[model samples]
Target chain A: MKDKELLKLVKQAKNYDSKAFGLLYEQFVSKVYNYIYYRTGSFIEAEDLTAQTFLKAFDAIGKFDGQKASFPTWLIRIANNLTIDYFRLKGRRPEVPIEYACENCDDCNLEETVLINAMSDRVKGLISGLTDEQQQVMILKFNLHFTNNEIAKAMGKTEGSIKSLQHRALSKIRKILEEEDG
Target chain B: MDNKLENALENCITLIRNREEGIDDCLARYPNLRKSLEPLLRAALAVDEVLPEISPSMEFKKSFGAKLDAMVEDKRKKFVLPRKASRKRIPPCVSAAATKCFNNGVCNCLYLCCLRCGNDGCIRQQSSRQLTLPGKESS
Candidate 1:
């Protein structure tokens, strides 16, 4: 369905329309799951966060402002905020500086070497070197395919600032990889 | 070969690092370089790469839906939202301009309804046009 239709469904959902709510849920669950998964990096955490994101969206659907952003973007902002809240409550910070950092290697034919747990150690080691902010931007941009403007909106920063931050963050990854190569 | 390869590698790295072109643009340009450079890019990407697949669990949804239904039914607990409603509802034709009214009102039924009605008609019309054109991009 188009944004307008989805928005209509969301409105119906707010009015306690079960069918409309179901349609909206179908429309947004994947986005919510992916956003949560991207942030938390754990299927379990993503699943939990996805649930929380929707529950919150459902609770606050009545107050959603379409003028501020599209329904998907608004939902994403909600998911992102909730994930941040989860981190705050835990008092645990991520070891990686960048967020996404993916290269579509899931199809690498070397299953034993690339796919399963074989590269986990190396991957984990590389990410351990990044800073928290870098990690956030990297994941949001690379993993989730969020534009600089969207990321900036999510992070409460200007687009130019986000572009610069993204550049610096990716540069750090390049440096780390270069060092590893040597 | 290493120096010549190094120059190409630098360009490849910058492109990959910048994410400028298609993901495999450099690899396509230099097959030999691909053999040498892909591992590095792969390693760089893999580091901290978390592939959390989205589980479309119908069971989870049903259980959660049931729980929410119970809460709403049993508690009759009304939760007050953070923002106040500004404009209640606006008619369909006036919607694009009445974005202000939609934002002001807490209930979005009228606004969404109007948008949906308009979009549904527009999309239907576009589809009919595409069918006649046959070779168009099917906008």
Candidate 2:
């Protein structure tokens, strides 16, 4: 659904409309699930995390101010925060190592070796080398098709900061890829 | 980066944005830099294609929907259910009488028993003595 339609649902949901909330859930669960899947590369973990994300979002949606962030961005922030908390609780960072590449086998049905072979190691290696924050921005922006403004909103950073981070990340990845090819 | 590289990067960016716009259309639209940024542009174009599609399972959706319904119902029930102050409870004597008084709400029923405070004691005495009904002697 479009953002305006979603906002309408949100308004109805705020008044305690379960069907409207269900529609909102259907609209966002996949996007949120995919974002988590990209970060974790574990379907089971992604499913569990996505469930928690929506539950937390529903609980807190009453206090959400739409002026500050779009609903998707807000949902993403909640998901990102929960993923971070999960990692912190596990005493590890939430990252899928480049070596353990997965290409949504159910969607595309590509094997691990095929996925790893499809991308130049240079891109994957550089991405893996990036700081967690930078990597998240790149993944959310370039890989996941989130706008810089949306990334900024989701990450709680300024738009200018997101742009600079994206530039630096791209330059670094480009340099690494160039070096590897040279 | 030099102007050439910058222009190349800009072209790459535009191409990446329009990557989903189809290759022939992109090639026809911007013929100049497509040749230079071909590899990077191709990679960028294929990035999303390579990204796996993740779908929630039917079972998970059913369960999640059920869970969401339950949670929302639980929240709604909070408002709809009677408040503590509004809930009514019959006095134990009235409840007992209701049960013993021929199952009718009429207080004037012949079987009506109003033995309030000592009802339990009287019932216990009758039961112990095996008295079947009122005015009966344990023989």
Candidate 3:
């Protein structure tokens, strides 16, 4: 959505307009869900956190400042904070089996599915190794498809710092993979 | 981390992500930075990266939306809401905006409202919008 249109929707939402808030929820639900899904690695927990994020957003919509961050950024920030709190409260992320990540596709070949899921598990393990900010950089960029500027703004940093974080994250993953091969 | 190289890497990664450029295409854009950029770009691209696709199900969205509507309803209830009346009722006069008719005589509506008339039930019908009651000084 264009910034102008988004601004208008946010204004309405601040005024407690249900339809406008619903539109914002629909537009951002997937992105927020995916962010939590990656951090928590459990669909059920991701759903719970995603719901909490929106509920908190609805309650605090009046406090949102368009000058500070874009709506998506503010919304994502809420999801990010909730994810952090969830992990902090739980003490550790439980090791959910990779197979449980997706529903069974009866039509797909079993061998191919197992191979693909294994690869996904390995990739997620590598990403989970990065620092919270670095891992967040990766998720915001790759999964949510946020630009460097948007990520920086959401994160309260400069675009330059965001670029550096992304580079460091990818470089760290590369080194880890290389060490495994060596 | 060279600032120029970082900017180039950011642009190239964005391009690569959007399918507007490939490793070779991004490298070609910054030939001088190739040696440094190529390694990072390779790392960015090399991973067979498929993060989980476990999005919220449809049932979750429907339930959450309904919950949000309930919240909005509750907020709306907190305001000075006007409700439908069988007979047109006057706004209550308990507020400091009470008329200065302190003659110990004819009140505009309070005499009948607080004492007698059934149609004008200001003291009884109960409009919560009565923000302020008359102070002891007024009585």
Candidate 4:
């Protein structure tokens, strides 16, 4: 949706318009679900967290300000917070088994599927080694395609900090991959 | 870890992401850190390439939407307008706007008061107030 139209919807949603809120939900549900899925690595947990994120956003929509951060940015922030809370409550990050992650991709040849799953699993394993902040930055940057500015807003950090985090995270991942290759 | 090297690495990643330039250009720009940063950038790029995008299952999506609608309905019941106030017919737009506000989990009385005021400014003020409430402490 255009910024103007989204703002209008947000305004209406703020006034308690369920239909307008549903429109916002329709617009962002996939993105939010994808983001949570990447973070939690569990389809079931991602579904639950994604639902919680929107419910929280619904309850708090009256407070969203488009000027400070775009709607998706704000929503991602909420998703991130909920993911963190889930991790805290669970006391560990759940790894999605390669088989589980690859269950839906029936189009690929068997060998291609195996190769892709292996690479994906390797990449995710390496990423799991980074600090929480670094992992968050990498996922938001590479997976979600958030810009440094938007990420900074979502993560509540300065753009410079985000740049540094991304650099350090990438550097760490590179080192791990190099060691495996060697 | 060096500040200069970090800046060069960040710039290289940005350039690579944008497909603006090749690694040779980045290496030339930061000759001192090339050997260390080069492999890292390549590894980062490789990992970036392999990250998968997952979609929620259809059943989950349908169920979630239904669940959310039910929650909204339950909240609507909790904040129903009083009988005396409901007797005085409200403009469709105003009532719609007020209903929206109530659905947002705003206090029932506040929205009711705004509706009772029956002017654009009251609604606008209430909306502004609602916008600021959650953002003040957190943002």
Candidate 5:
């Protein structure tokens, strides 16, 4: 939806308009889920985190100032915080669940599934080895296609730092992929 | 040269993302940078290819939708600002009339209808004299 339309819906949602809230949920739920899925790496946990993110958003939408952040960025920030909290509480990072990765594997046969899962594991593992900020920069850049300035704002870093992080992350991943191939 | 490479990679990658140029062509545009940019570009593509943009299952969507509906309804129910309703005050004139009727044994019809009274405000009879007067309430 257009920004103006989204703002109108947000205004309505702030007023407890259920229909408007539902529209907003429909529009953003998947993006939010995908973001959390990457951060948490489990469908179940991602779903749970996604639900909490929306609930928290619902509770606090009244205080959301559109001038400060776009709704998508705001939602991602919430999901990111919740994912950090989940890790902090669990006291351990999650191993990628091949099962969830293969859940929507485009109906591939078993062999194709294995091949794809292997590459997915490699990519995820390489990314997981990066520092938290680097991983976030990579994910926001590659997965969400956010520009450097937007990612900087979301990650609370300067655009210069974001560019540095992205460059370093890409170089690291490329080095890993090259070594593994060799 | 690191800053230069960052800007070049960003520009070429943005071109790829926008489909304005192919990767090979973009890399070709920067021959000196190709060696630096090729592996990263290839690695980025590998990651993007396998990291599929997946959505929640229909089952999950249905369940979350139900949950969100309940939440919106809950907020709808709770959104009431609960204005303190101002009560309608009984008019002072009517109350004064009633109070006078309680205090005197006279009818309140004059105050009620702007007619004469027996010189007092109460629920009693009047004499057989029609004189313009104010009930105790008006007095």
Candidate 6:
């Protein structure tokens, strides 16, 4: 939808229009789900978090200020915060479930699924070793395809800091891969 | 790593992703940092490859939509209905006139006329006259 139309729908949704809210949900559900999936590395948790994010958004849409953030940015921030809270509640970092990853690969053949799962596990393991900020930057950059400035806005960081974070993350991942190969 | 090299590597990555520059151009631009930058770029590519796009299942979408509908319905019941009911409620005198008009089969026009006049006393007098009529007592 165009920005003008989306803004109008947002206004209607703020008035508790269920149909307008449903349209916004349809537009954002997949992006929000994929973001949480990458962060939590678990489909079940991602699904739960995505639901919570939207429910929370629906409850808070009245207070949402368009000047403060676009709808997607605001929604993604909620998802990111919920994922953090999930980690705090569990008292553990997210773990890549290789079996779950393999089972969810509907588009890949058996051989391709196995290889992709292996690579995913390894990469997730490597990323999980980084600081939370670094991991988030990498995921936003590579997985979600956000530009540095967009990631900065979503993360509440400067674009310069995002560039440094991406650089450091890549450098650390390279070191880990080298050590593993040796 | 030196800050310059780090900045250069980041710029190279951006350029390569944007198709503005190739690996050879990047390597030639920073020959002294080639070895370090190359591995980092390769790791970046590997990370990109490993990040798969997983979508929500059909069951999830269906259930979530149902759940959202229920929540919205509940919210409407809690917040919207009361406000609308309050806004549409007719005053007592107007309601009496409305009842009399209903019996005469002219309520729609009477109600619209009352709304246009915006006079409670007018509606009250109108209703009192109707009430005095013997046959209209039921109204």
Question: Can you give the lDDT of residue A59 in candidate 3?
Answer: 86
Highest lDDT scorer: 6
lDDT of 2 by residue, A24-139 (tens): 88888888887776676566777899999989988887998889898889999999998888788989875554334345545433554475445534435555666678777766
Candidate maximizing DockQ: 5
- Give the clashing pairs for model 3: none
Query: What are the TM-scores, per candidate, against the unseen true structure?
Result: 0.56, 0.65, 0.74, 0.68, 0.74, 0.70
lDDT of 5 by residue, B1-139 (tens): 2876777788887898789999999989889888887887887776666565667766777788888888888867765433222223567798889888776644444444434443554422333233326563333
- Ranked candidates, highest DockQ first: 5, 6, 3, 4, 2, 1
lDDT of 2 by residue, B1-139 (tens): 2445445544555665765555556555656765644555444443444454456555677798789878977876675344533555557788788687755545333223433333576655644454365687557
lDDT of 6 at A179: 89
> Ranking under TM-score, best-scoring first?
5, 3, 6, 4, 2, 1
CAPRI category for model 1: incorrect
| Candidate DockQ scores, in order | 0.05, 0.14, 0.24, 0.22, 0.33, 0.31
Cα lDDT tens digits, model 5, A1-182, are 89999999999999888889889999989888877776767768888999999999998999998998888888888888898899889998654443434635444345645654666676566777777788777778877877887887777779899977877777888888878889
Interface RMSD of each: 7.6, 4.5, 3.9, 3.6, 3.1, 3.1
Candidate 3 vs candidate 6, TM-score winner: 3
State candidate 5's DockQ. Answer: 0.33
State the lDDT of candidate 4 residue by residue for B1-139, as single tens digits. Answer: 5668666766887897789988788788888888877887786677577665555666777788888867766665555444436767787899899889777655766677676675779685865575565647433
Ranking by lDDT: 6, 4, 5, 3, 2, 1
lDDT for each residue of candidate 1 in A40-60, tens digit (9 for 90 to 100)? 656567668877877787778
Candidate 3 ranges beyond 4 A from true positions:
A93-99, A104-119, A179-182, B46-48, B52-54, B80-139
Candidate 6 runs further than 4 Å off: A95-99, A102-118, A180-182, B1-38, B90-139
TM-score of chain A, cand. 4: 0.85
Per-model root-mean-square deviation over C-alphas = 20.2, 13.3, 10.8, 16.0, 9.1, 9.1
What TM-score results for chain B when candidate 5 is compared with the true chain B? Answer: 0.54
